[model samples]
Target: EREWPLAYVPLLIDEKEWAEISAGLVQRADLFEAILADIYGPNRLIEKGILPAGLIAASPEYLRPIAGIRPASGHFLHMVAFELGRGPDGRWW
Candidate 1:
């Protein structure tokens, strides 16, 4: 398997459990939004739960430093995997 992971959320959550679970989203969003705002003047949805931290971090392509700062725009996994070969330092970028 390339990767395996598990996540659990209360899509069918009860009213009493709703607030508690969602609370973490609020707190997490606050922290995330603050960081983004400081960087990009508030990224709207990225500040909301709609966009996730891992997604932004996992974005295979992006140039926040080279583009966001320097400009000219930017953006995926620029990685390569060998069929059955491997090397210690030739790891994926």
Candidate 2:
């Protein structure tokens, strides 16, 4: 596959997989929403020692210098792209 977002996925012959993929898409959206919310908020997981602080601090993907600068629309990501795959345990990854 192209690793493109679901919005860009073209029609295929796998109609039986439609419902499964749709459910996965919904779940992926929910995960993105939760991650965004946690990152910008109190961040209990990071504060409580559940997740490592280095996880965010060392990520070059997030520019920390831009914190608190809200855009006019007040949303960091007006558009988000998500791709889904499975873990070795047969669970969603």
Candidate 3:
């Protein structure tokens, strides 16, 4: 399949647009890291009356198979990606 035909067009983004996109991605990654820390640790978000316990209980992907398995060295989130695209209205999502 190495010689399979492919169709692609190069995207041209300005420096300002790239900066905005990068900022949004970094913010999302930071949020995910905080959430993972809460889920695997003391869960102060729930204890402090911030996040509802039922919300966690109802999540399908909540700690099920790997309930008590801690990370190798306290590193929870290893990798993450955001599939963003510019919308018709020139908004990145």
**Candidate with the greatest lDDT versus the true structure:** 3
What is candidate 2's lDDT per residue for 1-93, written digit by digit as tens? 665444556546356666777777778777776565566655676888877879887887766756445546655555767655655785544
TM-score on alpha carbons, each prediction: 0.33, 0.55, 0.68
Model 1 misplaced regions, further than 4 Å: 1-11, 41-93
Question: Per-residue lDDT of 1-93 in model 1, one digit per residue for the tens?
Answer: 344333345235567655764665566566654554443434455667677756766676533664234223321212223222124674211
Sorting all predicted structures by TM-score, with the top scorer first, yields: 3, 2, 1
Residue 21 of candidate 1: its Cα lDDT? 49
Q: Model 3, residue 80: what's the lDDT? A: 97
List the candidates ranked by lDDT, beginning with the highest. Answer: 3, 2, 1
**Which candidate model has the greater lDDT, 1 or 2?**
2
Worst 10 residues of 2 by lDDT: 4-13
Higher-lDDT candidate of 1 and 3 = 3
Clash pairs, model 1 backbone: 60-76, 61-75, 61-76, 62-75
The global C-alpha lDDT for each of the candidates, from Candidate 1 onward, is: 0.47, 0.64, 0.78
| Model 3 poorest 10 in a row by lDDT | 1-10
